[model samples]
Target: MSTIDIIGLDGYENAYPRELSGGMRQRVGFARALAVEPEILCMDEPFSALDVLTAENLRSELLRLWQAGDVPTTAVLIVTHGIEEAVSLADRVVILGGDPGHVRTTLPINLPHPRNRKSALFQQITDLVYTILSEKDYEVSPDDIAVLNQGMYATFQPAPASDSFQQAASLSQRKPKSSRSEPFEAFETARPTNLDISEEWAPNQDSPLRYPQLPAVRIGSVTGLLSFIAEDDVDLYVLGQRLQLDVDDLYPLIEAANILGLIELNEGDARISAKGQRFVGASIDERKHMIRIAALSAPEARLVAQIYRLLSQAAKQELPEDLIFDTILLKHFSPLKARKQLDIAIEWGRYAELFGYEAPTGTLFLDRGDEPAE
Candidate 1:
């Protein structure tokens, strides 16, 4: 009772989870977790789905409880994409880099509690963390920059698009690395421009059945993003600034474009690829074909494409929705991400004319009634 009350669900004890709002349900989750009063609490991107104010309120309450010694947990471990959130909460910030992800560096945040986000020191720390996350873990040699200057990144593009593929990663699996890092002057000197950073960022093989997530974007937005890159290259940080979004938020869009060979990421810049050049000019039908081929081709987005294919082939191009949720999406994505991936697949696949679903029948088929016109 104390746990539930502390977590802000004072009168909702008898309420079913379905009756609660998303944020309320999240609070309920915290209440349940705290009921046992475990020694350590581990949270993975816990606030990612919440609205900004709700997430802020929740974090504030959690901090209040911890500061006042109201909770029994000795330590809270949180994995998040929000840098400011990390800095505001974590005492030690561990930066993860490279595919198969490893800690590249650990920087201690020695700031006093109840940190000020607008302060000069806070901005400085955030900048340092940004540079750390952006940099390749390995030292860059001048010789490497010299080679990359000769247009080596062009080769980073995937094999020519195919009409069909059994595995997306097999056909679309490309090794992507481009060079450049703006060094944080606080701890490092200026970095060389035009580097071959292939070793830094590459697709994971997911050897032991690891699942890749679909970008939290729709197909329509991707077209606009591609068009922006096609017009002229743009730095990722610059884009983030313009959009008032975190740098991490932009990576998914970049990855989606990279998976489809619609754009190439170099250093912090996103430049259009040859396929992207064609995509901008392609007709509606041709565009869908391009996307379909790319989906069945790349390692990153390939799994989602494959899942869509499985759903399509099941029951001769028609299957129950339960089959999609229980057998397909859930198998690949975590429970939290499975429904999102389904929504993503539905919206994205429709743009590619990929597949369709019937709600009442709980069937997967090739119907495009709601597909947007070009």
Candidate 2:
């Protein structure tokens, strides 16, 4: 009964699963998870199925209870894709990435209780996490986050560039040439020592490469983000509020823009790059040309360029969209994850005019190029 009251399902205790709304069902899940009084509570995308308001409400309730010492667990471990949620809830945020899923870096969240997402310090802290996760800096000490709580948000020390991944170029079974009508710059990368073949996309192996990991976000939203900033510096927290985006919804958009070289992040502010200003001003055709050049330059999956290169190697210069999944994305991600990643890649490629697709048949092929503008 106490658990029922805690989850707001007190009167629905006797109700069957089918009799309750989806949010109610989620509340019941919370009740069950809490009933046992486990030492460490684990939640995997707990609110993913709930509507936005319900998720917010539930998160609020849980936060309230945790602060009040009503939560039974000694620790709460959440595996989430929401960047802000992690920062909001944890004392320490552990980010995991790469093919085999290693800890990219862990940072301390030193904010006071009942955190304010709108606080300037909060925004800067979130940006630091984004920086670590985006740039894939493994050697970065956890102490890096210490600067934020000390009121020093201006500068960041990028640890020395570590060894490059050996899997990117050397693992390619053959050096396939781009066969498009207007050929693209080759996927120029250093050959590391290995002959491994796997479906997971490799990060860029450029000798001096230092990119934030590609946030799992789509090209459309990223374009929208660029349009939102429009050549001005905007506070990221206010940016989130103006867009009515939760901390998580806006992370990908920010990371994508930063990684694509369209924006620069500093002290919780996002400043549009000169390239971004041009992207905002360019004609539709010109935008595609620019994105084509930028995205291909992305080391993460060579997002657009690599796909175009692969299609060229195909006998028909095209293949079922799912084929890329089997050959490149699947070995590292589950089918659903692979599909989501490929879908975004397809969206960006199609938007960049790097490739074309037939949705009904899931076919992906090269799109004719208008040479990218300088």
Off by over 4 Å in 1: 1-206, 230-233, 367-374
Give the Cα error of residue 249 in candidate 1, in Å: 3.8
What is the TM-score of candidate 2?
Answer: 0.43
Task: Report clash pairs, candidate 1.
Answer: 168-296, 168-297, 172-297, 321-362
TM-scores for all predictions: 0.42, 0.43
lDDT of 1: 0.57
Q: Write model 1 residue lDDT over 1-374, tens digit each, in one string.
A: 67865664543443455535566678788887888989998889988997553465456557656765778999998999999888777777887776787777776666554455555565766766776677776443455334323332222232222100000122122222322231111111221112222222233456554656778764444554553343356888876675556867667777777777788787878877766655544433445666765664455664445545564345575556666677556656677788777766655555455565554464555433322222
* lDDT for each candidate structure: 0.57, 0.59
Best by lDDT: 2
Question: What is the Å distance of residue 277 in model 1 from its true position?
Answer: 0.7
